[model samples]
Target: MATYGDLRWGVHLMKRILFLMSDTGGGHRSAAEAISDALKIRYGEANMQIELVDVFRACHWPLNKMPEFYPWIVNKSARAWGWGYRLANMRPIYSLNKRMIYYGNRQRLHNIIQNHAADVVISVHSVITPPMMYAYQSLSQRPPFITVVTDLVSTPRYWYDPRVDFTFLPTQKAYERGLRRGLEPERMRVVGLPVHPRFSALRERATVRAEHGWDDGLPVVMMVAGMDGMGRLYHTARAIDAQNLNCRLAIITGKNAALKARLEAQTWNQPTDVYGFVRDMADKMTAADMLVTKAGPATISEAFIAGLPVILSDRIPGQEDGNVTHVVENGAGVYAPTPAQVAETVAAWLADDGAQLRQRKANARRLANPSAVWQVADAIWEYAHAAYIPAPKKSSRSARYRILKPEATPQR
Candidate 1:
């Protein structure tokens, strides 16, 4: 048996961890990255190796094209997307879907698993969870598998699997949903969503504003439409600018070149700055007094850590409906479904010297769990250490070796 001190002192070989995810939305990849960063920070990078794989992209034909179609489905028709989400969640439909996935890409998935050879496998995307679990069934030697739910309140049924060693949920509502989905109670934990550690670090607001050359006196409203810019961002920005309110605007058109160019070409009545795909979002959030954006789980989590009040501009119907309710019911934000409504809500929050806005900020702070990433990293470390089995050295011709093996089980 290897003790904690022995493992820490390099008595065992480095552990490899494979993080399974897809770019269907930015949240999944971002969650994987955050967890990877947290693990590296808590345990020295030299002690472990981490690899991120986009399982959907590695699949065949139509399945491999999901990342390309995701933005179109959400932006073109949210109703259609909602219908698909609901339909696929049904037991019959989901079972068929899982079978098709497994049969269609079994060889590719097996090759991926064999090549990676991880000591622990963690999945942050729901689409690949079942397929990956199915792939592990064929392996004689398999690693401990875990799932981390990135959604806040309402999670799809595909996110749960009874075979998973453990499930980490972002909210209590999600934990309850896991129970309803037939996951073991002892194997589930309710830790907040994994956000980048930078979000938790406190930065001086005025200093960040100064660095960005933003006005120190005027209230700044940071508007965003997610990483792909898949929302009615142009119309909302115009409506807010048309308000002629006593505030400044900072619009981030993430990866939307045309939108950024159009916004820059037009004249505004207020002090406005337009940017495209900014890397320093934490700094931008720190300089802003409030946030006006779509209901992305990662963005909401980051805003909470920054203690910034939010005005939700849009959401995917079935996937993000619970997020809107969670924010509004907790008094951290308001649901403004239209451009005009978003503008009106912003104006109201900016009234009376921002008394209402200050309260919302307080509520956001109260809801924040800045240490969530560390908590999740600690749990992963514990499980990974427990599951690790060091490789044995080759025996000489004159010598014989006896290796003891445990009985194989279907589930952990």
Candidate 2:
């Protein structure tokens, strides 16, 4: 038998992990990628085979409306989307919607579960969890089903399903919410959200700034418009440039080609560099003194991991509100919803030898959960060794409270 530290070396057979995510938002895919990287780092690549399966695109048809409508509502009609989100949070509405989704994608769910023969099936999306648990119950013998909630604090009703063997939450708030939702305390572990391990492996800020040809003495403020670059990028950049705070700007206009072109064409008051979709995000983050972006859970978590303080410009309604609160309450950063506010916050932080700024940065680092990736990997490995059988359900249609404990419970 293989020891815990050296499973791959001892076993000839490789274990397969299937990560189920939908493209409704970028966070789920990012989380999947983080776990995949963590597995390779901890267990040799030869030992573990990780496959990221986009559940909605590959399996669930028609029910993929969430991904399709997400960008539309977020970009075109945010208020309407917010109203819809609030409506969805109501128990009857949420339950009805969930059932429709599961029934609509039932066959696809079954196919995904049976076809992959995954040693461990992990879900990072909220909507997919119950269906995944239902599908897992269908199998005569199955691998453990784990749910990793992507949200930091503001989790919705659909995020908690009782069928998962182990639930990994990112914050104490999430764990508390899980308990409120009736998830067993033992099954829920408050392992912070996994960021890409590279964020943890950041080079020194001064070295990175020098490499990027940035002035080492000037404050480096990074403005990110999220992966889609949906926010008011032009206005925010202009606001920061207007400030005479002796600062330089590193603007990450993620995947917004038109915006990138426009920003590059214009002359800036402050020393500025504009980038399209970035691959070396960690290095850029490392070179910065502060981050100005939306209240995306993944972005906030990644910035925390890089020890970069943030100024949240905006957030998706309902889901991302808690992320902003998490940052402000924890003193990791502040909430600045407008261009003027963002600039003011940046200018204020850049002054006084950055004494207050340094404190906030320290707070950000304190909230940093850089070890989350490895912690999650360890949990999965630990669970995989135990005897976990899919509990028999009284009714397939109604998901009851099922305890997913191992037959022989290991003492924590």
Candidate 3:
């Protein structure tokens, strides 16, 4: 019943939203932008303001591998480091990762809380939540903090504490995972993934095609590599091209100069587009018939709402693999292991719209919950009212954190 303007906390003036993000993988930051855009569009600029920031860019990141450009690193040290990251993601390392992330960013985050006083604070990164919550306890004036998880696979690391006012989930499986983890069911909301509002317009396929100057019959295939402007694009493109599939290809080769150069080198007679880093992804999603990429939760969720069938491919190990599993198991995308297989599936979809595409599209519709933004905005409004006191009582310190395991557990 809480509409956008219905706030007892005088938040009908819900003036601003601070979207905290990082430059880690493009998915996290991109998810933040998507939600903020939704708030601005639904609430109107006069009623709301949105600001996006990169916590990592504020300081700069030391080189991290695999998920953050470590394809070669995963190849080089297959056993030592990559295995460690994957294995740690299991139930054992959850508490240890939680502590390391908390104390590391504790002070700097305290400053962020002191400086920006929005009605609500939202984070796309799970790692940042523990630290932010620790700092939130110190401020005399703090806003409600919500963690919008960009990953579909819920791990113990993500459900760190009960301090978060709400945790937004991407899938039914993730919601169930949260319930199993003892997260407060009232505070846990399954709003699907926060997708850009542009994807929510629900335009007819013919209407979308006319805007792009494409024939109504031609299937539009959009290829995206997160915001880094990347993913096994060349090979993926080559695989698609080899089929001479009847679909038009729109390749989004995000900021990677080498990837862009390689894509430019290829010659194709079919209708094709090769661009680097587009500011309006919702427009791109609106214009496409299908999405092809590694199954980042943000991209998958966006595609799900737009009713675009997805070809899930090119995943890194650990969380990305988990996300892809959720998408496939939920029937949101076709599980394609190779570029050729992806092309074959695309051909089947185009050959008979009733074939694979039809089923996947149904799955996507079943999977999407477009109301997540309003839910988040609603929670933020609540945060404004509840955050009248800046700090938690010291006597209640133990209430802030949950001990996942015993103290004698070994640290890696």
The lDDT for every candidate, in the order shown, is: 0.84, 0.81, 0.67
Candidate 2: Cα lDDT at 277: 94
Range of the 10 consecutive residues with the lowest summed lDDT in candidate 2: 1-10
Clashing pairs in 1: none
Better of 2 and 3 by TM-score: 2
lDDT score, residue 52, model 2? 79
- Deviation (Å) of 83 in candidate 1: 0.3
| Candidate 3 or 2, higher lDDT | 2
Model 1: CA > 4 A from native: 1-11, 388-412
**Best-first order by lDDT:** 1, 2, 3
| Candidate 2 per-residue lDDT over residues 314-347, each given as its tens digit | 8888878889899999999999999999999999
* TM-score of each predicted structure versus truth: 0.91, 0.90, 0.81
User: Model 1, 291: alpha-carbon shift in Å?
Assistant: 0.7
Per-structure clash totals for the candidates: 0, 0, 3
Pairs with backbone N, CA or C atoms under 3 Å apart (clashes), candidate 2:
none
